[model samples]
Target: MDAPISWAEARTAMHEAGRQGARPAVAVPLSETDGTTLAAPLTSRTDVPAFPASAVDGWAVRGPQPWIPEGRVLAGERPPALTRPGTCMEIATGAMVPEGTEAIVRLECAHHEHGRITGVARARRDWREAGEEVSAGEELLPAGSPVTPAVIGLAASSGHDTLHVHRPPSAAVLVFGDELKTAGLPGLGRIRDSLGPSVPSWLRRLGALPVEGPAHPVADTLEDHLAALTSALKTADIVCTTGGTMHGPADHLHPALRELGAEYLVDTVAVRPGSPMLAARLPGGKFVCGLPGNPQAALTALMTLTEPLIAGLTRRPLPSLRTVPVAEETIGRGDFTHLAAARLDTHGRAHTLGHAASSMLRGVAAGDGFVVVSPGGVVDAGMHVPFLPLPLYAGEAPVAVRQEGVPAVPLPDQAHAHSTAPR
Candidate 1:
């Protein structure tokens, strides 16, 4: 940490390291493949809809005639041929339309009887055509596509039994400092280990499987640091360490990293409160990130820097954030940008929270998300400020359980949430 490195410079360095580490070849089962990357392009073995079907609970009618009910066709049941004009078959939602029908008039808009029907309205034009959703032999999903719930459902509906997906990366977290204690356990003159709980959760959110640790605390010695770092590096695709990257009296990561021939991508960034973050690539094609030990600072670095590096390494596309109006003012100035924890009110406005120190996890804990307040200027109320939505686990209090089994809550339509800023 000789001088603060510019954010742009840090990003470039991390990007380069990410590129060098990008040889993803992990595979996983379909049961655990949600959000995993596709190894090859997915083409349709059969058409979506598979047949000409009704889009609504309506009567299937032949072309160019007034509606008349000939028979009833329930869903998944076939009907006889339409051999005469003005013949309409009652069809339920998702039922296959008769071979000669071109339009569907909903039951509400048509007059019906036991064996005959009439008086269909002119406005009932809701008919679903065959192959409208997917073609018979087209590419439904391209190779390298991340498997989402929608993609998996589509693939299953289109007759796929299994899919090839990139596996989650193995992550090893190492904590340095003999003074640290296991969470919730107390020892005299020792602090609880903050990085242990937080880092594993973050890695899990990034589609990585965190390897639980021996939780070794390195003394302020070069040999001690090297031994711990070497053990973690050998077992993980990525190794992240806490506390030792700093230049303070206890810092030993710099020397330990050098001993392992770790290439420095960026040792520091020009952002407030979390600039001491470091990214490096080990010689054996693994990544090692040195994160600050303060709870909030390390969390910010994970979201802003390490998350993107993980995405690049896994070949997953990073999400783009959009600008939203600020509900309050933010003060800062410089060439670098700041990711501040804030609440996005219901009306798409960002309200700044006061607790922003590197050690203050309360701001993030209470807020709905973070606002990316640029250092170039002060953002006023109603001004569009870019920000990121924190993970569902973060920015909220722990959930409670009732006596009975808790009902599953439906997720909100994230596509329409307007209060977010793009990455």
Candidate 2:
């Protein structure tokens, strides 16, 4: 028997394949740029504020207390430059402060009587100076950065009406099994299909566009598998096939790829429950991911291969697996990386979610992410172990890095909102 590829090796192969086939960048309106990645560095077209602006709702004064009121400047209107010292202008937040303005006095900090404003403030130049936030021709965001909501706001403030971003990758899901049903309860040696709905959510979470349509069902026969594979590759940048990854008599993924002259990037990965996961590069440069029939195994396959693939296709960085300390002992396959569903409690510790068998989704539904236990090593409490948030489950970064990793909410049509029959 051949040894399965290391998890890192499998991911690298998929990422390289995806990079080779990454769709070219296109200019999209700012509204549609979210969830994509910048194909090129973002430069400000003009100064961020374009002029000195009030940082708060107050009065812009020069030379401090008891200044004569000149006029009022509401947001969106410009005030003429100050003629001399001891002059003041009422200003609202975001309103442009007149040139030669020294400081902004908060409404509560200023005492006005007989058209004169008096204030006791120590700070000077309290308003934002021109080019303070960003100067024209300055780089705002680097290439490969995710186009998050905050990024959108920055681009707009930097005078960008649209963004150059990677075109969203397209996908197709092929579910291979003769005994799979799409709806209603399963019985009589048949199970309901689960990949039809869940995998699309994962795809969207990684920045892929919606699947072309419902998944194509494949029977155990080689002919059905060949036909489905051929058609799915034509329009999809990547094709996800659930089931038929092993060498069982009915497994036809290998034979189908062979017939199509496809090259196997990953025959298997050394991960528990999903060791049979596979990836291949099609003759035309598209990708095919073979996921085990078991739901958890398929999800593991997704995390190992599909996530990096989408990241590369979107021209984004494939970051290191984030890890957190585990609070409880968990164990799994000693020969391969052990993956278990887990929750992070308020104290910042990972706790296992029980019932995490390859065939069960209950633990996944109850968990926030996957806990990683290294091969052959017993994970002890307080051990720093790898963890991956489920599709659309990762929340916002700390306040300090919020702009870089803003929170993302799952779409209403995403998997969390939709249910697929179990298979």
Candidate 3:
């Protein structure tokens, strides 16, 4: 058997693969462009709101003056005559303030009378200044910037109709198995095709458009395996196949990959439960990642190797992992690093979850993240552990849930909470 590659080496290879050809382009309406990467920088032709707008439901007025209601000047309408001193104009939220207005005072701060407004109190500093939110000719959305809900709203506010964004990389997946059954279907000896649904959904989360190919039978013959791989790469920026990539009785992916002149980068990894992972780049420049058949192993490869590939294509920096303290002792085998699924409790303490077998997916799903045990000996409790975050759907950062009386070191970096997921 060939020697396996280390995690750092695999990551380096995968990241290098991300620097390939130009990504596809797409013109998406501003409303649907959230979470997409900008293909070019968007410059504001006009200031956001185009004029001074009221941030609160109040009266627009000049500074150091009492409000004297003369006539209403709602948003989108011209300011009433300022011929009289102490005159005020009523402005609604999101409404544009008329000319000569220097600031906005909340309605409650002024006294209302019959056809007159006065008795302004406690001056407000919260006026929406013109060109403050977005200036004319300013870079509205820079190229390579990922659009968030706030970004989309800001772009729309700046008068953008269509956004130029990098079209997400498309993927085709091939699952090799005769003993695998479709999800939610009855199975006797055959196992459920866990990779089929999980990999697609994961790819989508990673900002790639996933195409699921037909499942091929697990074969000992290299010819059968090569055909399956060839089909997957036909329309994919990257092809990911499950099983047969490692060194074993049915490891046909290695020989087939060699036949295609694929530049094999990492054939195996030093990580537990996912050591059989393989990565290669074809002559045409498309990348390939082969994951072990075990469900968790495939997930490990996806999170580790595949994410960098998508980041490279999309021109996004791969998110950094959060570092937290392990709440219990862990003994390492020294030959390989252990990526044990773990629960990060409310108190920020990371506890290793049992049933870390590569074949187990249920435990992985239940885990908040994973505790990485480097080659050596036991990882004692209360020791800090580095962990890769799972794809959490919530918009906010997850609060740590810690065991009672156990002190946990807070993860230093919380910026990893940001993601490319569509809001």
Best-fitting candidate, measured by TM-score? Answer: 2
Whole-model lDDT per candidate? 0.69, 0.78, 0.71
What is the TM-score of candidate 1?
A: 0.76
Residue lDDT tens for model 2, 305-410: 9988887787766645555678777775756877788888897678998788899988888887787666665766676665666664322221212224433322
Clashes of 2: 1
lDDT of 3 by residue, 138-234 (tens): 9865677666787787777777899888766788787776677775574678777788777877777766778867754445578887887787788
Candidate 1 lDDT over 305-408, as tens digits, reads: 67667666666555345465787777653545676788877877778787888877878888866666555656666767556666554212112111135332
Write the number of the candidate with greater TM-score, choosing between 1 and 3. Answer: 3
Better of 1 and 3 by lDDT: 3
User: What TM-score fits each model?
Assistant: 0.76, 0.86, 0.82
Error (Å) of candidate 2 at residue 32 is: 2.5
Query: How well does candidate 3 score on lDDT at residue 405?
Result: 44
Model 1 residue 382 lDDT score: 76
